[model samples]
Target: MLELEGIETGYGETRVVHGLDLTVREGTVHALLGRNGVGKSTTLKSVIGQLPVTVGTVRLAGQQISGRLPHDIARLGVAYVPETRDIFGALTVRENLELAGRLAGPGADWTVDRIVAFFPNLAERLNNGGHELSGGEQQMLAVGRALMASPRILMLDEPTEGLAPIIIQQIFGKLKELKASGLTILLVEQNLNFALGLADDISLMGRGQIVWRGDAAALKADDQAHARWLGV
Candidate 1:
């Protein structure tokens, strides 16, 4: 239940996203697919208030959120997992989750223990410093921190980036389970196979605009569409 209409954004004078539009339905995963420098992340930043919309509007369940502060937007049920693992290097894994929980306030869907349960490895390393964890573990910690906020919609940017294949599978599996449990997700991904495999709907973007949008499964049957729009 998020919508972006005619969104135009950029860093300073160099515009990166132009006239972007998309809708994310509740209880489903909507993917934003594009190559590098195509404004996929910029679009997300615009929606989440990291980058203000130069034009157009962003709405959640129909109310406008375009101009709200980043923290306010987050408080309104949008959780972001950035491409960079934004974990505190010196903080304990548990402490990170706790801080996230406190920042999001109470009444979150997932508790600290619930997050620990979902990530058992993190549970064992609860007191360990963030720097001590492996890359996969760090990724898990990032997701766990976001989950602690108990968001209504989760926007993940390259959740599988740099992870081993097995770890990626584990992460995707968990994401699928979350979708099954009614979590609406907006995913920004470059791994075509990975995005198509899990996305309910996929939109291919180029140069800051959506070039194609369709059911994820349909892309496989239409090689021409894939070749022309996705460059795959």
Candidate 2:
């Protein structure tokens, strides 16, 4: 569902991602794993149109999406939940979801009611301000808001960062449900077990390029690649 070929992008004069090539198949969870400073996030930024692709191509569903505006790319059915977990601090939980649904427009399968059902904890805190929620609730709100867009492909960067193990399990459970419902996912994760447990396919990145690509079982069994590139 998503493809990047020879993707090269960086901040300012220093190039971080070098000739990165990767693909995420439809209805599958593709995990991009690497140690810090290897440009995993940069590759995601390039695909989502936040970073300029100086070289190579990005395609979604067989159409060229490279160089498109971020919102334009989003309208093409890509939903990105950055590591920042950016949500309006002052808005009520219900209000945030409302705004997201409005932005997503009509005819989307993800309605406020549907999302509230998917996230029942969010339903209980409908009137609470975003700032009043706990870390886990905030993360759930972020994912819930993204789903309000009814996106075909969900791209997450460090979705489990800084959360407790219980919270991580909850988030992963939601993700598993989403995957079961046939949504494609591209995840950049640091937790080896989390990625290995959930990912259908895995790609190890090193020095800004994909060094190995295989199924999750293969990645689990490849001790050399894990030690060399992932430092696991």
Clashing pairs in 2: none
Per-residue C-alpha lDDT of model 2 across residues 152-189, encoded as one tens digit per residue: 89999999999999999989999999999999999999
C-alpha lDDT of all candidate models, in order: 0.88, 0.89
TM-score of each: 0.97, 0.96
lDDT of 2 at 219: 78
Q: Please give, for residues 44-80, the per-residue lDDT of candidate 1 as tens digits.
A: 8888899989899999989899999999998888989
TM accuracy, model 1:
0.97
Clashes of 1: 0
Residue 38, model 2: lDDT of 91
**Residue-pair clashes per candidate:** 0, 0
Off by over 4 Å in 2: none
